[model samples]
Target chain A: MKILVVDDEQDVQVLFEQRFRKEIKAGEMQFVFAFSGENALAYLNQHEHEAVLILSDINMPGMSGLDLLEKIKKTYVKPPPIVMMITAYGDAENFNMAKNLGADDFLTKPLDFTLLKEKLKTIN
Target chain B: MNFDFLLIVFVARYLRTALKNTQQNSVWDDRLKLAMYVAIALFVASVIFRDAETIMAWVGHLCLLGCIYILYKETFFKPAKSLIVAILPYAVVATIIQFLQLVLPSFYRGNHSMVDSLKGFAVLWGIGVWMVTIKQKKELDKTNEKVVQQEHDNRIITAMKDELEVQVAERTAELTRQKEALETALQELQSTQAQLIQSEKMASLGELTAGIAHEIQNPLNFVNNFSEVSNELIGEMNEELSKGDIAEAMMIADDIRQNLEKINHHGKRADAIVKGMLQHSRSSNSIKEPTDINKLADEYFRLAYHGLRARDKSFNATLKTDYDETIGNIIIIPQDIGRVILNLITNAFYVVDEKRKFGIEGYEPTVFVSTKKRIDKVLISVEDNGNGIPQSIVDKIFQPFFTTKPSGQGTGLGLSMSYDIVTQGHGGTIKVETAVGKGTTFIISLPI
Candidate 1:
């Protein structure tokens, strides 16, 4: 399984890489990193159907996660990739909005990598 | 005739005594004395010239007319129509008796002595009547004087009352005008006070949001993730040890150690951010203490940068600092000075950010903060490479409520408050240097 992680903070890349080191070594999962939603979309456009799951942070400088999700859901409908939104605010308004925008899942920071791994396992 | 002469002498003596007792220093007194002398002369002439009785009588009549003229000229008794009418009949009868005595002796020779005595008696009666009329005129003069004095006092009282009423009206109008002015000023003050409170609340909210979202949250996320990763690494290490893979366990142990250090570093970062926020929120006690000026400036610079970045994620600026090694801890109110430093740095960043948004060609936004140790003072400066303030408004920049920013965007009190904190609270001087289209620098000089 291939996954794309999008966040504004560069440190999230290191954290994700370290947390999934076992799976990466076992060759069961592969991860790609993008610093912003716009970069993630650019990556997706260059390599279509390469990633099975997209984990993105909602709050960003440009091209927020919800916009990317809406574009992805609208353009890639035949083999829709699962998109999970992560946010510091876990308010009901954001949750409902994400749900209405066809987000596959919602996660609140500080994220639980164990639960995320379990969910990835179920998807696999 | 002898008895009449004696009566005239007696009346003249009585009038002289009355004039002396009254002490009336008037022309009327002199005239009365002259009349008394004339009456005495007439009486002596009448005795000396018994054969010239007609000449004596004529002289007596002339003296009486002179006395009447003096009385009229004195003006002490203004003769009214009623008093003149009362004396008219007496005056006519006296004149008729004098004429009859002079002319009837030739017509009726019978009882010539009786007629002469009758003439003397008539003369005495007329003199007595004239004396009584003078007394009555004096009494009337006294009553007239009292009436005139009362009228004068009444006119003065009336004039005084009119003046007092005018003054009262003027005072009431002045008081009313002052009351209206005070009420208007009070209303304006109340409205301004309410606006100030509202702006204060908004400013604090912005600070709180920036501090919580960027300063505390970022490091806290790192600390949590690093610790969780370390926990996982520890579990993996135990598993490898149980399998008797000593080399793998050592590798995992090393990773955990590095993770622990990262965790410690991130934890301290979060702790420092919280402490800085607490310091800002705490009310200033205005107590002077020894503080490292360089460290203080550096800390506030980072805080203001992060705060601005938290609000506007696209904002970017290069920060530079120069600190004098010789300048150590200086005694100052750290909190107040910190606020002043923060305010200046924030303003510097704001101006540069505004210029950056203008998309000037080859423009790079930069902020420089420097501290220098002078002979007997310390100087702190914040400089920004942004469009400089116009010369027209530069002088008014430190005045309260003076701002170039649009209304509601800025409370306009930030620079003024900073000026107060630097100059009044810390006993320092704040000055600004700027050049058009180049930049602005705010310098603060503090006595050692």
Candidate 2:
């Protein structure tokens, strides 16, 4: 499965790469990284249906995680990719709002790779 | 003959009573009595000595006239024209009687005696009228004196009342002036209080912006540390694989796994710190939560430094920190405590930056932040190697609206607000220590 990870922090790319090193080396998963919501949207437009999963952070400089989720859910109707939101704010308000905006899943940061791996296996 | 003597006695008695009623001095009384006795004696002599009767009668009339003059003079101070006019008829009658007695002795003896008696009666009647007039005049004088006394008393009372009114007006004016002055002072105090509150809000907003720059470093640091460790581990594993040492390679891989876990742990800590910061930014509520003191102090130190750097690019200061790790987490209102820390660190940076601008040779600007756990309290101190606070103004450093910064640059509420947050808000203590030229340190102690 191809997964697109979106975060403002550049070091997040390296972190995700290292965390999924075994999966990538074993050819079980391919990862793509975008440092902003705008870049992630641009990548999706260039290669439609290329990314089966989109992981995004909610609090970014521009085009917040919810906004990107709305656009993706509205535009990509055929075989729509799964969208997950990650936020430092784990409050019920943000969770409910993201859920209402059609977010497939919600995760709180310091993303648990163990749990995330289990969830990814189920999606497969 | 008996009627003449009775008439003379009656006139004498009337004069005595009038004199007594006049209330004159003893001298006048004595003289009037002598005159009365002489008149009576002469009358009695005339009755007894018939040959010299006319001469005695004339002398008696003269003596009565003299008594009348004395009485009138004493009562009125000077004899009035009416009294003199009343005595004139008697004097004229007496003179006529004397002439007739001298000119016609036999005829005068027959008719002149009757005329003389009638003249004496007339004189007595005139004297009675004069006494009555004197008494009336005396009563009138008494009434005038009483009226004059009443007018004088009324004038004095009016004057006193006017003076009292003037005094009341002056007192009222004075009180009004005091009230207006106090009102103006109160207005000024209210405006200054408003400005101080506004500046505090501005300071918190600045801190929030600086927090973004300071918070990103934690996750980045974790990523760098683990990445370098994993790189070294991969090299070791590759060498063991080339040497066909599979067990050793497996051990190295396990170690790498532990390092990755550590990286994950640090990443979670960064996330938690970010969440706390976001919560602090959102809520103004003073809710007590378990907070890491060292991390809080270190976070604010960097936040203040970065905030200053953003404003003035040329500014530079050496930062140092010594944190006590045993004080893991203490219960406190993290937002309030975080604001206080940010304020102190910002002030430290400001002082050091000011000293740096002086460009003193070999002078290095530095700010040091430290935390320690005592037996029952926690101490956080911020120190700056800048020109120390003068002894004279050291006590006023934490006073509201007292500032050393120039106009428009500072509101002077920073330290005062910090003092309130630590002391009044949290039941803590804040104090300052300083030297003339060395440096200054502010210490805050919070109960565990």
Candidate 3:
């Protein structure tokens, strides 16, 4: 199954890949990383119905995960991908903002890869 | 040489002196005028009937008694002008008696025809003196009438001055009241002006955020899509590698998969941040509704974390939550209180992040949010383990425009606005407890 990871920080993407290196090597899962909300959209427009799950950070410079989640929920019709909001700030307001925008779940960083992997396994 | 002639002379002289004294002095006693007539009769009777020694002695004694009355009137009653009239008659009587006793003593030795004749003349003289004294009293009365008129005018003038002073005092008090009211109105106007400026700033921020969010989302969706497809192709290649097809896997392995995954993850994170920025920038207005305290706290925590993460990517903090299920839903304006929670959490994270940069070891940044119900109040506490606030600045944290954060990172209004939200908006209390090295805990109490 293909999973999309969205964060503005390049280091965050490296951490996620490193943490899930075993799963990717075993061919059990595949990971896609988008550096920004704009990059994520650009990748999505070219290849549709590819990402089965989206793990996104709530805060970024230009386009945020809640906005992206809103667009994904609004535009997609059938069997939408599960969108989980991830933030370093475990603030209740941001969590509510993401949930209200139709996020499937929420998490905080330094990415709890164990829980994230388990959560992703359920979606898969 | 006769007793009656002597009496007549004394009565004339006494009448003349009494009239002259009444005219000279502004205040005179009316009793002095009546006593003068009694003195003339006493003197004539004492001289003409000299053999009636007892009657003559009684007349002399009455004259002496009048003199004593004059002395008493002069001494004790001197301050009052009214007492002068009371003593004037006594003075006239005493003067006549003095002349009769000293000048006509032989006439008082026995009764004689000449003395009898003299007594009739004395009566005539007494009538003449009474007429003259009456004329003198009229003249004095005219002068007294003028003095009374002057005194009346003085009293009226004094009353007018007193009334004017009272009016001035009242007007001054009214002016002071008006000035105080004007000052209060001026303060209210200044506060309104500040609020208008804040609203204008928020409006511009909202518009800018919405535009930025819209522009970023379009390109972000594109990157996310293509990255997902690339990952799928990489996955298919990985499947082939597991099935013993290494050549195809090698062609697709290093470049496409790595870059595409980077685009997907970070792209969505950027999108979420822009969205949060847009939502947070919205102007605050009263939106009262029933809200779950626990859920509200969780949302603000995430927003606070996102805000801190956006500033510095390396900041890491461990967060813990202990929500009391008993503290159920409470009515509130979510955004207002949400901002409060967001500010506290952001401050907590900043404290930890700053501490870490200074090579502080043996301590991991920790934030604990706990909720509890006590009687009729719900308490929400945000506790942070970091370099605690300094003693000098701790008391000033909730004051408007006060901050310990670096200039660009803090507007200095975060804690103040939070205080307003908790105390004024929600009718609750917000307090902070901190130790120099231990950490800080912000406790918010809301009435259920």
Cα lDDT computed for each candidate against the true fold: 0.76, 0.75, 0.67
DockQ score for model 3, please? Answer: 0.04
Global lDDT for candidate 1?
Answer: 0.76
Better of 2 and 3 by DockQ: 3
* Best model number under DockQ: 1
lDDT per residue for candidate 1 within A1-124, as digits (tens), equals 9999998778787788779989988999999999877799999999999999999886654466777788989988879999998866544655676788999998887888888989999999
Per-residue lDDT of B363-438 in model 1, one digit per residue for the tens?
8788999999999899999999999999999999998888777787777877887887787887889999999889
| DockQ-better candidate, 1 vs 2 | 1
Residue runs of model 1 more than 4 Å from their true location after superposition: A1-124, B1-150, B162-166, B169-198, B204-208, B243-261, B278-300, B323-335
* Candidate 1 chain B: 10-residue stretch with minimal lDDT: B80-89
What fnat does each of the candidate structures reach?
Answer: 0.37, 0.00, 0.04
- What's the best-to-worst order under lDDT? 1, 2, 3
What is candidate 3's lDDT per residue for B1-448, written digit by digit as tens? 1333233335434434544543434333345455556666666676777787655665554555445455456643333333224333433544444456567766644544555455445545555655665676678888889899889989999999999999999999999999999999999989976875475335334333433443354346445544654566678677979988887677557646665666665576566556545445656546777878787677566556644554444555666899999877889876667667777777787787777787766676778888999998999999988778888888899887687767754567778878878888889999999887778899999998
TM-score for each model: 0.58, 0.49, 0.44
Q: By the TM-score metric, which is better: model 1 or model 3?
A: 1
Rank candidates by DockQ, best first.
1, 3, 2
Q: Cα deviation of B125 in candidate 2 (Å)?
A: 7.3
